[model samples]
Target: MRQHLWMICASLALVTASSAMADNFGMAGCGLGSMVLQSNGKEQIFVGTTNGTSASQTFGITSGTSNCKDDAATVAAMYISVNQEALKRDIARGNGESISGLASILNCSDSDALGTSLQRNFGGIFQNTISDSKEVAVQIRQSVYSDTTLASSCKAI
Candidate 1:
C-alpha cells in the first residue's frame, strides 16, 4: 500500500511538472528573451536576465511585439490623457481635429461618427466637474467600447 501511494504521488508530480512546462511564457513573461530562448524551464534564468539587462520587455509591451500585445483601450486612454482639453471641446461640439486624431489613433474608420457619438455622451464622460484626465480617459474608453458604431468601426476598441 505504501509503494502504491508513492507511485500515485510520483504520477501527480509528473503531471504538475508537465502542466507547468505547457505554459507559453517562462518566469520572465513574454519578451524578446522568451521569444529567443523558447523554454519555460531553467532557461528562464537567462530569459529573465536578458529582459532585465536589455529592457526589451518594456519595449515589447509598449510596441506590441515579442509575443506581448498592447490593449487598444489602454492606448486610447493614454491619448485621451494627453489631449484632454482639446478632446473635451471636440467631443462636446461633435467635430474637431483632436477628435479626428483620436479616431485615427484608435484605428476608427469614420472620425465623424466617433465625434458625434462622444458629443451625445459628453455628460456621462465629464460627469459635471471631473477634472482628472485619467478618469476622463477611462470614461471615453468605456463610451467608445460600449457604442455599437464606434466599437465596430474602431479596431482598438
Candidate 2:
C-alpha cells in the first residue's frame, strides 16, 4: 500500500513537471529558450521581430544566421500538448499501441488479461476531461494499483 502511494506520487510529479506550454500568439520577446532550441531532430532558430508597438526598441533582435523557421519548436509544443488527448481517445477505444506505450512508460506490463480488462472498464477511470493531467495521472495510478486486473496489467517496477 505504501509502495502504491509512492508510485502515484512519482507519476503525478513527473506529469506536472512536463506539461506543455501554450504558444505565443503575437510577437514574442526573444529569450534563451527562443534563441537556442531544437526538436524532432530539426534545427531550431527564432527571431524577436519588431512589433508595431515597439519597432524602435527592438533593433536587430534576429541574427538572420539560419534560414530555418521556429516551426520545429511549435510542432514540438503541439505534439506534447495534443498527445494527452490522443492517449485518452486511444485508451477509450482500446488502441493496443497507445495502451502498450503508456504501460511501458508507467512500467506496468500485462501479466494476464489486464489489457482486456482495462478496455472493458476504461469508462470507470476516464469519464471526463483531464483538467489537471497530473492529478488524473495520480488517480489513475491509484486506481490501477487498487484494481486486481489493472494491477496485473502492469509490471511491478
Most accurate candidate by TM-score: 1
Most lDDT-accurate candidate: 1
Instruction: Candidate 1: list runs displaced more than 4 Å.
Output: 1-30, 37-44, 53-69
The pairs that clash in candidate 1 are: none
Candidate 2, residues 1-157: lDDT per residue as tens digits?
A: 9999998678646533442232222234333323222121222222233232334223323552222234432333333245656656666676656556566544565622435545555665566665445543554455567777666645542
lDDT of 2 at 105: 49
TM-score of 2: 0.38
| Candidate 1: tens digits of C-alpha lDDT, residues 84-113 | 989889988999999998898899999999
Task: Give the runs in model 2 whose Cα sits over 4 Å from its true position.
Answer: 1-82, 111-114
Instruction: Evaluate residue 146 in candidate 1 and report its C-alpha lDDT on the 0 to 100 scale.
Output: 86
Deviation from truth (RMSD, Å), model 2? 17.9
Which ten-residue region of model 1 has the weakest summed lDDT? 15-24
